[model samples]
Target: MSVSFHLCQPGGGASCGACCGLYNFRDHSRAALTRRLTAQTERLSRAPHTPEAYGEAARELTANRDAPALFPIVRVCPLLGFLDAEHQRVGCLGHPRVTGGVDLRDCGVYRATVCESFTCPSFGWLTDAQARLVQAACADWYLYGLVITDVEFVRGCLKLLEWELGGPASPDVLRERPDSLAAVRRLFALKETAPGRDGQATVFGRFAHDTEGEPTPRSLDYAALGTRAAPEDDVVLCLGYTPPDAPALLAARALVRDHVRAVAATFPA
Candidate 1:
């Protein structure tokens, strides 16, 4: 169940920059990030190919960054930007493949060696089938990076579907069935379409920043909510829900349950 292919830039309407700290900002919205990446791509495109020029541009971009990093420890690379003229895909702007054989990634925050070798946890954690399903479902750069990087969210959704069906909800099965695949896409789309998740830029799915700005996995306070832990809690938390009261918790739980149920119903009898 290991991924054999590179999950970062599979190039079928799917690409990711999470390892570049794409979603590390306090305002990681699609529109906000598009502007950020677009600006970087445009600015860097105009800079001379020399390391000095690129280095200066990188520093200027970093200094003028609009949003603060959610986790200060994470190094957000300024070289990450749109890979295509249409701005449909994102990747390292300074990569030799991008820069016409000139590897200028060293001018960014990290060295070219580190950038070339680094792999996100999803590379090891996600099964090839699961990775493909994510690629098929969240083909957009923004959604793909967000959903694919969150292992808990993807696993939580499939686990709940299995529970609902009283059997294994195979990633391959979901991918093979168009109806099931669309259902799964809807389930995963909750990452963007989920309600009441606004103003939670500091919360990255199931994680929130500690005082020192390190992402920490969070848990629902069942006692405070006057409720016991439910199966939907994992996905609910991964949906960036910080429920304030019993009703809020219940509502969030219901949202996840409904999506899981939708996926389960798509299965053939």
Candidate 2:
């Protein structure tokens, strides 16, 4: 269960700017964000169980609305800060200043029970090498991995890929299945309609395939999972990338599409 977080790392080349500033806060108002910061501050300040470092950082961030180092140009979470003037590097202000130390998750501000329990759907299930490759893609700043909604199905696909490739599904697998690149393109083209509200047919079952072009943020709708009725509950699928020349990534992408198509076949039109 090797877990890698692009946003949590400070000097890590793959750090994410999207989570705090770009899309995550798109719907949040200033007042709402302030309320959230205040709540997090309060949680960090609580007694006996509180980490002194977290409390201090949270209080400082909450009290100073215009903390220059704490606020990025994008106006994201107060906890975010840049290591360089160019803002090319960014990380959590809540983190200890110690060099090569632990991340914000290990710090006091994030020790709040709710924050401790939170896990993004996009966070798990990859080999260390796979994780590094994904992070490299994410370095483009325009790229982010999608969360797979059908975790079991996706895992199954990965397992099948590994079996077919005769090892961990590394980029090297692409050499054996050069056609996988084309398969990936084909999979992205397949779509189906799912029943939306009031008997309306909503088109879904397509996965994003373009990793080299402009970044397109998309969500998955598991219309095949007829038991679940809400879009939020739908299984998500994450698209990860390796270099365009890497065969494993192409193979993995093709496998994902093939699995998705197989799953989509199970649902009633």
Candidate 3:
């Protein structure tokens, strides 16, 4: 499938640091922290800035330089900090905190580097509207967003969109093919048609259950699939939150089904 990265931007009230945690900071060490800081400083220096601008940036960097030292020896990334009391917004602490807030790409060290190169399954898979729906549903900090672990499912969903719209599925594509929205709405409707009784509802039900307890079966499947991407690949289909109301849930389900069916259609049965 054709993939585009430039469309990547903050959506659904989620930020790049949303994924920051134990996995992102698995190698946090004194040496590693030092190197990370050095790299960030270098990038900042290289940024198009005048002497005064560089000086200001340097001060900001210095202010947050001890970030690694602040956190206890923990598995989670120390840089993961919340922007609000509700913790709905998450981002890097090491990054230069500006007047309004942190711009991960412009200030965050690892985020600017490693995370920038990697496109989470959501970004690569979901249409902008679908992604926003997932984000809005899981806007609260405690509730992790909805994650789609099945790569084939995601691919299938995109295929269905393309088939219906007569073009590659993307955020922009929706404008040209508004009818595609109806298809998405139908998918969500299917989710509510029988609640947990149907297979599709069961999939979403399991996802909800897993969000609160142990990893769901699909979660395991996603992890296994991610490993094939790279040796140390850390990725998953995280939707964050399930839809709150019946209407919203139904719409989200429709989006999910399109992908799931698309994957099933490709099987050599």
Candidate 4:
């Protein structure tokens, strides 16, 4: 189930800390996460590189964590922070590569071995091309992690595009053509741009926590909305749409349709 390429920190302006529980917080918006990571980076940069100092800093950061995890069961690491002075990348600050030959990830939420070995579902679910396209489309750490970690959102968008084109919407092709890649980027940008999905921090794209605190895939209540299911519904749900009624559902579908069509339009006529 291993992918041919690395999805985490694949370069070309892409990096991810999602496996470290980057997006587990309730307010995982770009602004909130930037503040959190910025604070962590600044604080850790001043601490001694010893395990004792790093562990204490980790505890203090967790104790003063800005927001509670949306999923209580998930572990959010305090060691995740911006890897660059410009704050364009996010990664494990405790990694030996960042800490100048000292591995301090053991001081974070998980052991160093676990952090080194763990691979998210994306490693298996996403092909090299798909992963590369996501990397290319989302250059910023915040948006890159948001879209790359969600395999369903990436796959759902591409599948819908294939349907719209009445043919294959190859990820490799999209990656090569600037115009097509730009269009595809707009489609993937729906992860952040889709409107009216606020106030539902509990809802992570198509999945929401049940009473037991486990994620469960949400479904469109067609019977309640009086509208039948559509192809775009999967992407719509992955976009975190909880449409209240038929009109709302249709609007969400239309939003997805426009983006999908835009990508398809870039194909040869």
Candidate 5:
């Protein structure tokens, strides 16, 4: 149910100049993306009665045609568009705006689970860590929980992943088999989401092993999620089939790891 718009800028050289490369810093914007997101999110300070309220606040930022920092001309990135005005988050950006655009139900971004689940590896404001990824591995668990609210979060995600990978999630399957819940909890503890030069995890996401040895991930468009991460990635097989091409979606499914060491491919160093 997700529709994606992608374009690659030629100037994005092999070094990923403004390409929005996933898991890598394609380029940095002079603007403070995090602050923008916080300001937008505060729209719910009064507590919106419906999703429409959320969508409207997000689009206010999107309407910016001039500020490239707000809407960068990325070569490769899913530009999440606001759905029709219904969820109650649309068209209330402190000015007169157009209404009757799209519905919150059909939003191009969060319509698919993949887009909602993915997070960017943001190494924001953390100075303690030499590399942002160091903070990333730490804060991932907390952010992971926020994305999915199921009680057995990781277990459910993996089970769904197993089924999507052309495998079934049997009830008798081990609950804490892949990574002990304890271990995962420990990892979250190490995560520091405080404000710093070298920040915590930048992104959150799911990936699929493509025909090539690449991990294809969905668009982690936090902008649509009502948050913002100054973006950029390739392909990976995820249980959530939401490629722009619905027909090819089934194809992304065909490469499921049947006799594969499932977890090995997912958890990378």
Candidate 6:
């Protein structure tokens, strides 16, 4: 089964991105390389880890330099496929609502079996189950608009997880909220309460082919997703923000249930 070009759903297949030259994004990586080449003199760059200090850089972007990527430092090297040359309005093509016009295999990894193969070391789930849940939740959060709400340092975990999963590692996912990542973590982990069909819902946060100006946006055929249903106990790992150890795993599970109740309270359709 092919993955959705809009939301990167769980399936088995490769995208054109893996074959960049054969695909349209051949120059996408080159453009970013050029930008970084002229951007370095790393010996002179300043590091700001504190929130107040971070605000200083944010001020510079909005008031002085007019730069995009407004946040503290990001460790992810190649932040690619941005909305503009400067990347001010970053977009995630993985969203079905956004990339409804794309074509099949137009993207690279999102449309491939990379999900089953991609694993982030930062996730360091103490147990296989925790790791699996985190993986599952991330996909759900990206594919579905499910939101996870909680107070734990989960958002931090999500950032670390995303980093390991080869995402931009940009703090943008946190959205100013300290626990934002954690919310995503929890939302993705609630697979137990998920109905039969919702499990295979396409996650758009992974692919954004439409935003890349493809002639016609494409998404995985949702009608056929049921045909690709995962087996009974072979958890797809793209579930949620998981803990590193056993105790933490239990805590993460409880948090997910609590969060599900809150979300259901607001929208019960």
CA-lDDT, candidates in order: 0.89, 0.37, 0.38, 0.89, 0.28, 0.29
Task: Give the TM-scores of the predictions, in the order they appear.
Answer: 0.97, 0.36, 0.33, 0.97, 0.24, 0.23
Candidate 2 achieves a global lDDT of 0.37
Better of 3 and 5 by lDDT: 3
Positional deviation of 9 in candidate 6, in angstroms?
A: 15
Model 5 scores a TM of: 0.24
Q: How accurate is candidate 3 locally (lDDT)?
A: 0.38
- What lDDT would candidate 4 get against the real structure? 0.89
Clashes of each: 0, 8, 20, 0, 49, 38
Superposition error at 37 for model 1 (Å): 0.8
Model 6, runs deviating above 4 Å:
1-81, 85-245
Candidate 3 lDDT tens digits, 109-215: 34457654655566565555555432333333222222222344334445554555455555333323435344443433332332333223223322332333333
- Ranked by TM-score, top first: 4, 1, 2, 3, 5, 6
**Stretches of candidate 5 above 4 Å error?**
1-31, 46-49, 64-66, 69-110, 116-269
What pairs collide in candidate 2? 54-109, 146-238, 148-236, 148-237, 149-235, 149-236, 171-248, 174-247
Query: What RMSD does model 2 have?
Result: 14.2
- Give candidate 6's TM-score: 0.23
Give every collision pair in model 4. none
Model 6, 84: alpha-carbon shift in Å?
1.9
User: Over the stretch 1-269, how does candidate 5's per-residue lDDT look in tens digits?
Assistant: 11121111111110111212212221122133223323443543333433566455445534642233312222222222111232212112221122234233222223434433443332122122212112222223223222222112223334444544456533222222345333333322221221121321222234333454344444534334343321001121112333444334333333322212243233333
lDDT for 107 in candidate 6 is 30
- In model 1, the number of clashes is 0
The best-first sequence of candidates by lDDT reads 1, 4, 3, 2, 6, 5
